[model samples]
Target: MDNTTTEDTSDTEEEILVYAEFADSVNIEKYNSMHILGIDTKTPIVQMNETFFTGTYENPLGTYMFFENDTSPQSTDPVFDRIPEKNVKYVCKTRKLLKVEHGYITPKDGSGQSTQNQAQQAQEDAIKMVSFKTVQEALDKFKQEWCTNESSSTDNNINNLKES
Candidate 1:
C-alpha cells in the first residue's frame, strides 16, 4: 500500500483578488501577473452598460495595491512624504499649475493665502468642473464646451469672409 501525496505546481503566477473602480463602474477582478502597472500600458478594460473604458494614467483603474515602503517620486530617501496606508482610499491629486499667465487670485483677509491652500482649492475647483457620473455625461460636457465656444468666433470669421 503506497500513501504518496503528489502536489501539482502547474502555474507560476498567483492570482490575486482586487477591487477596481473607474469610468463610473466597479469590478472585483482576479488580477493576473502579466498586468503592467503604469500610465502607458493600457489594461483592465471595462465595459459597463454598453460603454467601454480602458485604464489610463489620467483615469486609472484604482486598486489597493501599493508598496508601503515606496518613496515619493520627488525624493528617493526619507520614506517619502508618506506612503498611503492600507484600507485608506487615496485620491490622485490634480495640482494647479505653478504659474498662470495673466492670472490673479482674489485675496482673502486683504492678503494672499498659502500656496498649499491655493493649490488645493484649484484642484477642488478642477474636480468640480468635470465631475460626472458616466462617460456619456462627460462626453456631453465636452461637446457643449467645445462646440459652443468655437461657434461664435467661427461664425464671425465666416461672416467677415463673405463681406470681404
Candidate 2:
C-alpha cells in the first residue's frame, strides 16, 4: 500500500549548490552569506548552516565562499579563494546537545547576614542549565528575547521578557 516513490528519497539526498549566510564569529548579529557546495559533499553543511544563523536574524555582515576538497587553482572570485582544502566540512549533522547556563544572586540578601551571604553565594553558584536538541531550538531561545514585530511595540515589550 506504499504510494511514495523513490524520487521522494532521491530529492532529499540530491546534492545542489547552496548559498547561505554564515556567522563570522560568535556574535549572532554578524553573518557572511556565500555560495558553497551543498549537503551532498562531505563538507560540514550542518555546522556551516548553524554558524550562518547562530546569532540574530538581523542583517548580513559580509560574504565568503568555502569549497572543500578543491585542489585546483584559485578562481577569479576572491570568495572562492577563502576555501580551505583540509577540514572543510561546512555543516554538522551530529545530534549534540547545546547547553546554556544561567545564575543569579538572591535579592533577599540585602541585609547581608552571614547566613544570607552564604545562601546568596550558593544561589549564585547554582546555575540553571538548559539544553537544546537542535541549533534552531537554541536560536529560537535567543529570538524569543527580542521583539520581532515592527508594528506593535507594546506587545513586543510585554513578551520580550525571558521565559521561565
Candidate 3:
C-alpha cells in the first residue's frame, strides 16, 4: 500500500492583512505602494477619534494615505480657529457694517451681555416676525425658526465648556 498526502490548493484561500503607518510626512517608498492600491488620498489612514489624523495626498500619479504628525494640521489649527472667530463675531464683536447695514448686531459692547440681549431680542423678533394665520402655521414657523438656534446654542455652550 502506497500512502501519500495530497496538497489541496483549490479549496484553500489565503487571507492577507495589510497595515501601514500614516503621517503627514510619509516614507515615499511606502506612499508609492499604497498609491498603487488606489486608496483615497483624503481618507484617514489612522485615527484615534481626534487624537490622530490620517488621510491621503492626491497627485497626478495616485493617492497616498497619510497620518498627521505633530507638524500636521491640528484641532488648534486655523480651521479650528473658525470656532473662536465665529464665537467672537456672535458674542463679543461689534461691527459698524453689520450693525448699520444688516442689523445683525446692535451697536453695543457686544459682550456676553449683548449676546444674551440679542438672543432675547431675536426670540421677540421671531415671535413678532412670525404672523400666524393658523395655529399650525405658528407652530411650524416656530419649529423652523428656533430648532437650529436651540441645538446650536446648546452645542456651542458644551463646546465652550469642554476642557480641550
Candidate 4:
C-alpha cells in the first residue's frame, strides 16, 4: 500500500484587473470608440451596471487607468484621487460581457444558476479593488502611435487630390 499525494502544477498566468469610472454615457461611448479604433486593448472583463469599468492590463504594476470616488471601495495604494461623492451601484468581475436580451442587459450565464442570482453576484463584486492613474494615458499613446500618422497621411492624400 502506498499513501502518496501528487501535486498539480500548471503554467497558467493570472489575469490582470483594472478599474475605471465614467461620469456619463458619453464617456462610455468614447471608451467604446477608443476600443474599436485599437487605442485601448485591455478589453473589459466586467462592467458594472453603473459607471465602473474593469478590465485586464498588460502591466498591472506599471501605468494603468484608475478610478476615484469617495463612496467607492478603497485599495492598498494611495494613487487614486477622490472626486464627487456617489454610492457605487454594482461591480462585475466576470470575463464575459452581459447578454443583451431585447433592450436590456441580462446576466444569463446559461449554466445552472438563475440570471438574477448571477447578476446580483456580479454587482456585489463590483467594488474597486485595484487603482489606476488615468485611462487617457493609454489612449494618448495609442493615438500618437497610430491615429496621428494615419490622419496626416490621409490629409496629405486629400490635399493632393484637390490640387490635381
Task: Give lDDT tens digits, candidate 2, residues 1-164.
Answer: 98965654444554433343333324434435522233333332233223322222222233334445534545568965564555344432322222211212355545658778889899999988889999778867756654354346744554565342
lDDT of each: 0.46, 0.44, 0.42, 0.46
- Give the alpha carbon lDDT tens digit for every residue of 113-151 in model 3: 978998998888784444669977765565566656688
Which 10-residue window in model 4 sums to the lowest lDDT?
95-104
Could you tell me how far off, in angstroms, the CA of residue 120 lies in candidate 2 after the best superposition?
A: 2.1
**What digit string (tens of lDDT, one per residue) describes model 4 on residues 19-117?**
343323433443442321111454443432343333333323334433444465555556675543564534334332221111224565655667678
lDDT of 1 at 16: 43
The digit string of per-residue lDDT tens for model 1 on 1-164 reads 99999999697975443434343433424333222233224443444343334553333333344333334334346555553343343444432111111212354672445667788888888845347999777756765676577877765664565469
Candidate 3 shows a clash count of: 5
TM-score of each model, in listed order: 0.19, 0.19, 0.16, 0.18
The best candidate by TM-score is: 2
RMSD of each: 25.3, 24.5, 28.4, 26.8
After superposing candidate 3 on the true structure, give the runs of residues whose Cα lies further than 4 Å from its correct spot. 1-41, 47-51, 60-164
Ranking by TM-score: 2, 1, 4, 3
What's model 4's lDDT at 112? 62
**lDDT for residue 103 in candidate 4, whole number 0-100:** 22
